[model samples]
Target: MSPVRRGEKLPIYNRIGVLRAERKMTRAELAETVGINVQSVGALERGDNYPSLDLAFRICAVFDLPVEAVFSRTEFGAMSAELYRRPDLRPEPQSDPGGAR
Candidate 1:
């Protein structure tokens, strides 16, 4: 894995496994619905891989949730699309002088 950039991280989901589990749905079911492999579902559940845009929409369709309802961004990284929330609007100062400060 590469070093975490200022705005990037291995985005952990807010609710994929949790939601599916709540609905008594299996990984295979989600995979089929999203047109991905069950292993991919397992990977997503473990934060091992990120989903494609089409897959994201598919997941949302299955859950009847708005994109925002499923994704939430955090101070460090973005949340899964299925659980994404609004990003912070507060501004932060940038560093200079070779990031000495």
Candidate 2:
């Protein structure tokens, strides 16, 4: 049986790291503010792990950002085109903010 990969391509959300860098915050300080362990905060920044919804909320609150600003949902058709490098693989053209192809 073939293995099934689930979930959208979770494009990296290093916004946490961006926030930390902008604030010149240590991982320990950020973790303390977010009520998570320093290692968890480090992992999230490094993209070594994905955040749970609860953690996402906490991080967003800490950074004072709406969730959409911090995270993006992948559209499968876009992922397919990008991964395959085949423009023909894209879905019926939608209104793209990056400008229509």
TM-score of 2: 0.58
Cα RMSDs, all models: 12.4, 11.9
lDDT tens readout by residue for model 2, 2-99: 35457545555556776677779889998998788999988887778888888788888887888766665532233335447845565786687988
lDDT per residue for candidate 1 within 15-63, as digits (tens), equals: 6877797799999998888888899888876777867778777888999
The alpha-carbon lDDT assigned to residue 1 of candidate 2 equals: 46
Range of the 10 consecutive residues with the lowest summed lDDT in candidate 2 = 74-83
Cα TM-score per model = 0.60, 0.58
Name the best candidate (by TM-score): 1
Clashing pairs in 1: 70-82, 70-83, 70-84, 71-82, 71-83, 71-84, 71-85, 72-83, 72-84, 72-85
